[model samples]
Target: MSTRLRCLLAASAVALTAACGVGDQAGSNTVTMTVWTSNQAQLDLLNRLADDFSAQHDGADVRIQSVPQADYTTKISVRLAGGDAPDLGWLGAPDAVGMAASGQLADVGPALRNDPEYRFDDFVPAAFTNWRGGDAVYGVPFSTSPFFVIYNKDAFATANLPEPAELAARGDWTWDRLAGLARDLQPSLPRGHFVFQSNEGSVYGPLPVSWPTLDPLLRAHGAGFYDPQTKRCTLDSPAAAEAVGTFHRMAFDDRTAVPPGAQADFYAGNAAMTITQLSRLSQLEGAEFDYGIAPLPGGPGGQPHVTGQAGLVVFEQAPHKELATELLKYLTSEKAVRELAEFYPPARTSVLADAPEIYRDSRLSEQAVKDILVPGITEGHAFQYPRTWPEIKTTAQPVFDQLWSPGADVGSVLGRLCGEVGPLLKQAE
Candidate 1:
């Protein structure tokens, strides 16, 4: 057997032994969970929670391991497949679906339902949809962050252009207007600076990363990869074409956006604006330039707010399944959720209602958070995903690559993409 397979077999043996009561025994009195999040602020908060949980239980201790985001899903899958899974971990919407479907995740419903003090009903009903598979709840959403435009106030002033907030207030903040503003501002920026930065600065490769940057634009124009119910690709529609074409013009024709390989960050004042979650405001803690947050510009279809959701799940193969479930509950409880709100926007109705007070000490002003951030979360649609998302994303990568080509036909490229991925989408159904 290969080394990886051997390692998996060895891990499986360990798990089997643990299952038979050789590990996490009464005398052991400790639980260690691996979680995917490298952000120090997030980690610090989680560690504090772990400490609290430990304090409540006599002779019990909890340890948290931080895993890098890029490798988290793959690493978790390998560990699970190899029979060496963490007690619990954070899962993005797409990966959560796959893990739940494969039966790698433990159903957290009974534990949650049995805990009356947990206030399960307090959570936004919509936030739970992604974590549900049949009757089993595989995860508990912790972050329901919506995308917004983070702009450099200095850049807007230097360009003598109205900020996105001003345009939004006047109901003139549309994608077309944003594009025009970006183009107009490009001339005024210092050399090497640009107007807009998509999530993570490029969409040339990595479908998972690229899709977030593209999804909002598509939704803005009444387009989507597929209908969640119909399972039919909609990228070939006129609205999608217009949306893609507009972005194409910005990236290649107008040269307004940071091109495929170029680098610019809104937080660094290297670019005028970027589409991201408010969580990124942590990066601006000591930023040299003045910055402001604004809702995403509306498109032809009107404002289609998009959110990115992430959750906590316990692995089915976990040695301490019961303990992990309790941890998940504790981590998502009202108190924990409120504390996490400093970095992650909470999905709880009560917390969201008091968002202005909850985020009182946030980097963005209370007014800015209330005006731009709160509405986006309350009104945003979570990014859609299918069980076959990972496969479909890989398949569509090359097709999306055509968009980077100068003079590329947006309609043709997208139509071809639909043709290639249509079968995959159907299979996912």
Candidate 2:
């Protein structure tokens, strides 16, 4: 079985069904659009906004479906490919181009252009690049959230170590120092706890196609999976190997980051620090300890900050494209964007400027919002990924398991990965 399918199977046994419906259809008019997301908070918030949307649009209800993040992109991509596209949905920018090229996405440009008051131009130009071809816009980013560090304040206090906030204040927060801190704090962490956790903590899994699994570290080292323009794999480069090697050393040698088969979580206070983004803030509610948020550590690559993007798109096969477009406009306008900034962050330039205040009611303090969150979104590059990312992730999985073991040859493992993905890249060209 393919790794992606296995993810679906495993998720189904322990998780919710594909479309966990939001609420009752507004006034029984039935759901007009079904949007998919991996975030519970976002699902709830979008459902609330969708309620008002339904009221305004003759009671055309909108359903927000929540899926497990582990298999979300795969499940939704499979659905779209199987002729069962949602009327509208939350799609990752990485997958937008490929889906658009495959004729799976509808060009939303016309509806956007027809309405002058919508302020489509208010969106950052870079936000639309992956989803556009000339005047054709396949998607508009609803979330341009950037990756940052979330540290357990209690862990820092217990270890007698400076927190991320202090490090950022001293201009000493960088990945190298982070590595040292992970090790230095290890002896201080509770018996079963660690010092760091990577995004999702599934860096290398069952089948382990480990390509972009370590991309954040790759970027921190000024390396990437491949050169976008050339469509060539760079996973075997020295910098790339060194970055992955550092994580491996942390996992096996230092025993700091949660390893492949571990069960610790930062939000649960089992970890001292973790590299993650905002949507995860929902996990912090009513937590047992205070937590500090800070920018991703700087590195030789100079604080590699990559904004993870999700855009609202109307699928081509959607039955009510016009209505879907209208709902899209309503949900992404400046007013709605400001409201969404409380969690998802915003792509609208006007709304982006006022993020700190918009999020004042949330758990994050204004300084955290201004110093860490806003800059990561405003100045960070939208994660530049190949249109072939889904293919690359699937095809490269099996080859990555080799490098997870102690003393595993990083260079050789990544070389094999490059070989596995070479055919996929060539086809892209």
Candidate 3:
């Protein structure tokens, strides 16, 4: 651990002690496995799975905890630093490398290989990129969900705009078209309603989801927060400015997109469209209004297929390594994975082949699933961040806020942002 990280741990000692006693259990042949998830709605389902595991394994206890997605990364970091890490937790692709590089994650590769029925080879090769370090597999992706646009069907009908699916079918689905559609759809909405909302809520998040909101926009324009190879901030590139300027115009110039301070939820029918993944389909399963799924809008980068992943990992410091590995194996077994795929996108090749049939009657139509969702998961890039990314976010909060204003020059704002975080990115690791 670095001197700075040790200082942070020492400063947080009190709170960590109070908040970190949930993972250990003392009994004969009994283990309390702590699991973390972002979706609380699935608590009942997860508990049932845990119950089943306990029944099968001589009553080893399992507990699933849901942490707010916004604070997940930081809280996990604090817990690990305090030696109170959960037995198992879900880590997103962008956050996985940082945690593994920090020596916080465990390698389950050997256990997986020893269990022939586990069929580790059945997992998609692409989904393992962020979870693997050379020959060691630190985690396995449970949700390899691709970012796609979900739109309000009624809003499109009211605005007399062709559905995004139709546009995509005709090879006309593009970011420029999406902006125009948002602008044209605005007049039909009531006050406080917008045509579009940023993906997953925050425009510039502080901790857990810093890049996801802007990732689709930036990558579609061939821009990113930083270059992985060069280890330099690149948000000041012309392509990035163009992408940011486009969003700025929608928020301020056209007043079509929900701004930083405004409220709009795509699932609530307050916005016409949003960029999200299959895992979010459950939110719309019982919504009153009808929704539509479409391929992500193509841009100068030719429809960059970006994906976000949730990989399951056993913490290195977990109290029961043997029991935790057993739980991991059971949770990711073929049957359990198929059940999870009913809600989130699956990374296993076996389930993916039959996924369209399963989702055909769900929120997505069979055609939409095959056309957009399946291809997206199969051919998408996971967003990777450097180990020092949290530091960059902390230092760049003020500059990020300045980029959303009406009078803010997009290039200059991002230039200032890069200037502030560039050194951090350069010196990462």
Candidate 4:
């Protein structure tokens, strides 16, 4: 049987065993474990697993709270601080550092240690590293995703541009080359049709289009926002300034990308390319247009960085927190990993190696999964990736606003941004 098929079989056996145990239990009951999920599909999957979990534990109820993406973090935080938090909840990994300071997350070291089936080493290094602090596992990585340049195949051909496949094969599709392509295609596109921007209007767009991916680019250019040893934010350094300069040109000068206007442009064949999350692949199930995915273009530094987000952590104070931990362990098991891989890649290396179909979907997503699941496996990790980069985006808003206008002095605008953000970085230390 195929690895994926075997994984499904294992999960089915586990579920069946749990159900049989539930049948045996006449009046016994276990604690109710409440789990908060962000996406609908994830909630559905969790609900199904909850049925299995409940059946196995007899009287153990798994209550799920589905939160909209807009309100997920804020709502979870409010509940956590108000002392009414669920036993288990989703915590985006990039935001994990700040959440870790809350004292709510249980040190999952014991849980991981006791469960050999849910081995830590099986995880992608980045996923494992983000979940660990002080030699303890705080959370189990769930869905693993990577950033990619999703292009409208029709648009590319319409402009007579080289195919993304050829670009990747030739190793000539660097960030500089992409910038040039964006510039060249700008005049051909209608006034507002260019690149797709995520939540740029409300904040600084989505994680995929902005910060984390940008981190590798900045690092490739010899710039990093933080000094880990000193724990300082070095965002205002010269390298940072150059990175910002390049961004200003991309957004305003070249008009290759758009901010928060018409997302359907790319989906509708109006825009040529979009730097977006692979998880968005779920949205493409019935896509009518022919599309191709490629890794984010490399820079002069010869490395391409793809952005990613981490999984949910349970708080220590939550009711049935132990059960919460158990659920987390179960969700990240090789069995669950393979099941989830039907839509998303497993966060564990063992699972990745065992299930190759997940990585076979698209070129860019494949590279991203490869980087996380294998050590020194690719050049992507050598470059820095920002964990909490929203602060930088906060500082860039006004700068970008000014630069986007007609005849704005790019150098002066960037100089002001450096001066403003430099102090904030030092304070973040």
* TM-score leader: 1
Ranking by TM-score: 1, 3, 2, 4
Candidate 3 lDDT, 1-429, residue by residue in tens = 100001112234355334433534333333433335445456656667777888888777565555556567777788788777767777876677777877888999999988999999998788887888778888888788888888889988987889998998898887788889887889999899998887877774563464555777788888887888888889889999988888888889999888877888888888888888776777885687888888878788887777888888888888777788888888888888888777678878789899778787676788878877777777877776676766777788888888867799999989999999998888874
- TM-score each candidate: 0.90, 0.84, 0.86, 0.77
- TM-score of candidate 3 on Cα atoms, chains taken together: 0.86
The candidate that wins on lDDT is 1
Question: What ranking of all candidate models by lDDT puts the best one first?
Answer: 1, 3, 2, 4
What are the Cα lDDT values of the candidates?
0.79, 0.74, 0.76, 0.57
lDDT of 2 by residue, 167-220 (tens): 878989877788898888899877989988777576766332232236567887
Candidate 2 matches the true fold with a TM-score of: 0.84
* Candidate 2: regions farther than 4 A off: 1-31, 37-84, 133-135, 206-213
Query: Alpha-carbon error at 277 in model 3, in Å?
Result: 2.6
Per-residue lDDT, model 1, residue 384, is 67
Q: What is the lDDT of residue 151 in candidate 3?
A: 87
- The residue pairs in collision within model 2 are 174-298, 208-397, 209-396, 209-397
Model 1 Cα RMSD, Å?
A: 5.3
lDDT of 4 by residue, 209-290 (tens): 4554456556656666567556555555676666656655676666665643434346656666766665565556666778
Error of 4 at 285 (Å): 4.7
